[model samples]
Target: MSDQSRLGLINENPIQNGLDAFRALFTSICTSRNLPSTIDTLRQLGVEDLRNLALTLFTSLRNLPVSGSLHSTSGSATLRSVLLRLITAVASDSFDFDRIKPLLEIAISENTQDAQIWDFVSTAAAESTPPPRSIASSLQQTPCSQNTSSFVNSSEYRQNVDPVLKLELEHLYVGLPNFHKSFFGDIPELDMVSEAVFRKCTEGDSPLFKEGWSGWPAGAKESDVLTWIGGLISQLEAFADNRIPTSAARRKLLAQPKTPLEGSTGKRSMDIGFVDSDIIYKPDTTDSRYRWAHILVVGELKSNPKADIASAAWIDLARYAREVLAAQDTRRFVLGFTLCGSLMRVWEFDRLGGIASEQFDINKEEGGLQFVATILGFLRMNEEMLGFDPTIVTTSGQKYIKIERNGQTECLIIDEVIKRAPCIAGRATTCWKAHRNDDPHNPLVIKDSWQYVDRDEEGELLQEATEKGVTNVARYYHHETVRIRTDDDVRNNVRKGLDVTKATNFQPKRTLPSNVGGTVSRISRQGRSSSSGVKRPSSETDAALPPSKRSYSASPTKPNLDVLSNRIHRRVVLRDYGEAIYKASSRAALLDALEGCI
Candidate 1:
């Protein structure tokens, strides 16, 4: 009898009592923040424990043909339960053994080490296969040999072979930044293992196994891997020929508690304590070449409900990469954040991070990628709103992407007017790289500055806007309604106005010609404090944009009254302190001259 049958489970009957029993224990342990006690196994006793439980189900040594993956046994009936649990677990924040180090390492090590008889493919090849080229010549010609670790400790090499999996879990074979470089040498990559598995099959000692692309971590070093794969073509050819037909009798397994589209009832709110400073990735790493992952967080409606590996790692990995980047960029300090609601919010100021460190704190430390995320989020909304209708920006809080059965599009509900905009958007490349023309909802999403092309006719639109009704100054400025105006005009307005004022006052006794290029000198002298976040204007700064980038307006135009108003505003701010200094200096000079005459 099957395990489910022996345990009194039947199809089409309620799975509630069994799954509920699982959930109660899982929640208790998680609430207690219990680390697995012995580290031998993450207990597989809960509904949410199904993630770790799935590992047990697939890789189990016993019941090979009955309770296994096609590569293993036959009667694994719990695939449906595990799938629902994985989807819900990933969507929420509760801990899963699969994501932890001890368990993950063990699982990876098993597939590579193959200690269990069921997993043991004939190692006639890996143990004895000759190197494709002469060993000496290959070692000599290889450029990487110089840096190769030469202290071949047999204990360390033998340590690579686990009873089932090595402690390093075969992943740090590539290297973990926290660990030394020669950690486990290298994990057998998927292609290398697949080739070895298939090659052994033709030698009569191999068992029949179903074949397909094992999910490869789509990461760095793919090209060189393909070259190594080329040497194993015969194994590929054989596996292609001997693969078993997928069973037609295999029936669809229903996800036990969920409807076809939704997730589980255990999609509960989780609490992750703030325990450590978040680290940033910087250029200071002893090993500058490190591989990290990035993830994009989508909203509830758009959140993926799949158990596939890549999808599962997306958002968390992106967050990991963001933290690493911030750590490296900031130096010494590690910043942490909370994955809060629809909005990306910072948790750095929480009681723990606020009081816990000596490096920096509430008064000294910097708010991190969480701050960056909030800034980018606002910037993303403005990119669309500014492009759709510059005037729409003042009301951008209402602009959002809407997905319908027909197509995806952005919707802006202004007052009662609903404006529909194209859902397709572009990604920000480096400030030096051209922006990418791609769909925003690319199953994989990344965060960077975003860009869009706005209609130049926006100024005319603004004029028409004001002509229709004259009191919307905030909307007009917010939208850059006169965005058609070139930066040259703004530059000239500032340089001819406040910049000129500051320079003239600084050299009170010396007369500098206004016609000369003192504009650059004047800009540099004011040296605005960093609080004004714009980069300081340089001497070589070009206020004149190319003709294509320069915007101009014609036809029934409103006077450049707003443009003039902004120029006046700049003059007012620039003049405030400069005027005060000039007045004080003039008073002091008069007093000094009167005293000299007496």
Candidate 2:
């Protein structure tokens, strides 16, 4: 049993897989893990067709990995930003400008304090300065700004790969350098926006939108999405109102009123206008609505109870709603949840009581209408709660966009409504995941020492997760194990595991003498000193050294650094709102300018 013998065992054992299999396994694993995936060489380039040939590569796995582990508090948001940027850039189908570059710059920045990105960007700018000879003078017209008014303009948001941005990010980890490459794993459905609504395994009938929705060529998909987005914006504006509107005058009494006026339904609508005051006033101006709506939508999505939902699939739900609302109507809406076929709703905020309703299936009065479009893609409120009457269910009725939630639920809805519903004032200070477990046949596993984290607008913890040790909110990622070694039993088990994996000399490499007579220095290859032919220090002398200088402590009883850091957690990273803000407002002279403003 010697170091040489251990090496011999390592060399003797045959690897199960060949080089090709190994490469495939490595690539696939690396991508899913968001590890450092590498490319061997650069290959091709076209004007705007950017296919990163050798940029990053992953090997295809023979079969799906049943489970994956997440890096503790590597800070997913930091990486998510990069992946989103890549998604935006690729979908934009153009790269002549800095469409994704500046956004990328904002993500990985250490702090607003010292923007090292600016230095690299400046350098890239100098390097990529296009000559006037072949450059279109159009490039110099409107400079990029943080404002949507400026950034979304075809002229301003152009993806012309300003050489400066390319060079700036070349050396940058680019927020989540490997996130886009893998980290979250495969989502092939996102290849197209329509796929967000359609079930991948089961291709159903044509879209059931009203008659007018028919003639739109596939290209009009863009228009449809836009209409959905508009409605969400309207819903959000209504939610932002300092005060919410009252209930619909408890309309139950009036519904059965014996004395009725001529053309009552129409007047009832007018009654809703004149007398009834229950409504979140939808904003008259455009920007106010979507702004508030954006906040709410993001908050809810972050509040989801499952990790699978957090993947890019969730974005599809929001995006699809936006696209449909943009093309169809700019009003309140309801969508179908993917799971359990339930109805979901968003009430648009107007000066009047904002309108909202849950979607129902084909027939009136059917108990299980199955209005939910898809499951696992969205959260669904039971049909009984929404009270959407079919008598008034028209494509033109109050701007309801329908859509399928990202596999959680199904149904179409206006994009803006989805966006706005996120902000609508509701009972948010509740544990959604906990409530689900109370239902019959709940299967969500409860873990010990686990807790939920709900951050308020001011970045305060509003609520904690269930006491049984399960994460109800998806946002509370396994931010490092609170303790790698928990109880005494766990500590003992880990010690055993370590002993099994110890780099002991009993399993040595290369043929060595069966005897133990070898250099003491070689036995402790990594320790002590480099002074050749010098006697090693005694245990007493080693003990005299400071704690930091010692190679190993006398015992393995020390606490784990990761566990300690989690127990005494530090660092507060904000969400993407800053991105919207920085892009919209005038560039701050310093990052500190944002402090105390909210």
Candidate 3:
């Protein structure tokens, strides 16, 4: 029969079909007394047929009588061995063991008297075929001081970043800044612009006022909005040049619209990019595009006011922030804005999560001042205030991170970046292969990550382990928690003026039945902290019942608040350990390394 017809026949009555097939195989085995031939016959069946047969056998074994005659027979021993081998073959042929693991456990539990059969099956099914070579052996054979170019080109080094789930985005970016308070109070550059200059730039006949600032007209395009905002920033710069002394004047920045940013490997283009004027006009071959490294601020524009937490515009904004953070090694955080119609919201993205100011109408007098302040603030801010790490500096065209150990200073020349966190939030760990200025022959690993403030420092743990003579651990050199000029941790500096209480829970968009009433009944799982009670749809019993019928006695009294953990920046230098263990040259080598670790 054809594969399709055979699959249909099994689907019609899987249990009966499985029993008949097994009976035929058993009869053949009895007649010939040849297990190899019987096993070969079973292999001829399709992958789908084998899966159905396995499930059917598991079910039948679960229901089998405990006092059956087959349990006492010598032939049953042979049959059980064959069954174990068959399941192992299925798993090796690409069947997902995790999908059927629960079912296997259930079958084993139901037939507790047949312990040997279940134990053998479990062991055989879990065994995977070993590769020819192990990663540990390969690393041992290779020299640690080898050039990094070869390692960079290896397939093992090209690990892709995991895609962020939609649910995670909702949870990470829910905190809203107070609408009345300015988010840029720390920026002293805003003081340079007097009330007269601010009024002149935003009042009647200004770029913003002329572009429907009072209210955006229906069907207004994003391109027109970008032009208006760009013109306003230019006017601000023009005024700053004439009023401020030459020594006090800040470097000029240009607001370009619909420009494709270079440096990032991603092909997506930005709606608007605020970039340094000097680098933007440089005589380079990039054709007027700004590199993501040089971009001071990123902007997104939407024709409509649907740029909510769940909207595509917000997702794109998050993606752009990730690209910028990845491109600039020293960047601590990212500043971005989304203009939805005439409404504007400024956002800050860091290793923990994202925070945003409440939307404001830019056409009004008060909102116009807020808009200009944001633009001018970004323009006049120094390198440190723009989110670049001050300790990491470029001297004579080479990037180096200054390290002070035992009151003596040294520089770690950054040779190559090995890994960077793929997401915008969470512990953004970055690894770099570097060497000290005096010792260029021996390279070291410099690891940087945003660790949780409450957890024990990794550097301390490593130091303790080394002092106690722990084997197979990376040799620790130096470690420090990065601090700002004000002597506060980087995490504390970024969270100023943000109110976590005002944050709202992310409600996924789902269509409900017409008969369903009130909000969807969501219950928080037990053991979750009261401060952030994350809720989700309940168990199967609750799913079968209507929303109103579902019991919510376990729900918390206070509404769920989307709060993020506070993380402090930490950097550690370690002795170069070669490539990862997965690159082992032989199975024995890999096994040996794993055995040592255990």
Number of the predicted model whose TM-score against the real structure is largest: 3
For all predictions, the C-alpha RMSD in Å is 33.3, 26.6, 16.8
Could you give candidate 1's per-residue lDDT for residues 146-189 as a string of tens digits?
00011111121111111111110111111112111111112223
On a 0 to 1 TM-score scale, where does candidate 3 land against the true structure?
Answer: 0.60
Q: Higher TM-score: candidate 1 or 2?
A: 2
TM-score against native, each model: 0.16, 0.19, 0.60
Q: What is the lDDT of candidate 1?
A: 0.22
- Which portions of model 2 show Cα errors greater than 4 Å? 1-43, 49-126, 129-308, 330-598
Better of 1 and 3 by TM-score: 3
User: What is each predicted model's overall lDDT from 0 to 1?
Assistant: 0.22, 0.21, 0.53
lDDT tens per residue, model 3, 272-373:
756665664544665656677777777777777765544345655766777788788788888888777767778777775666777777776776777777
Which window of ten consecutive residues has the lowest lDDT sum in model 2? 540-549
Worst 10-residue lDDT window for candidate 1 reads: 568-577
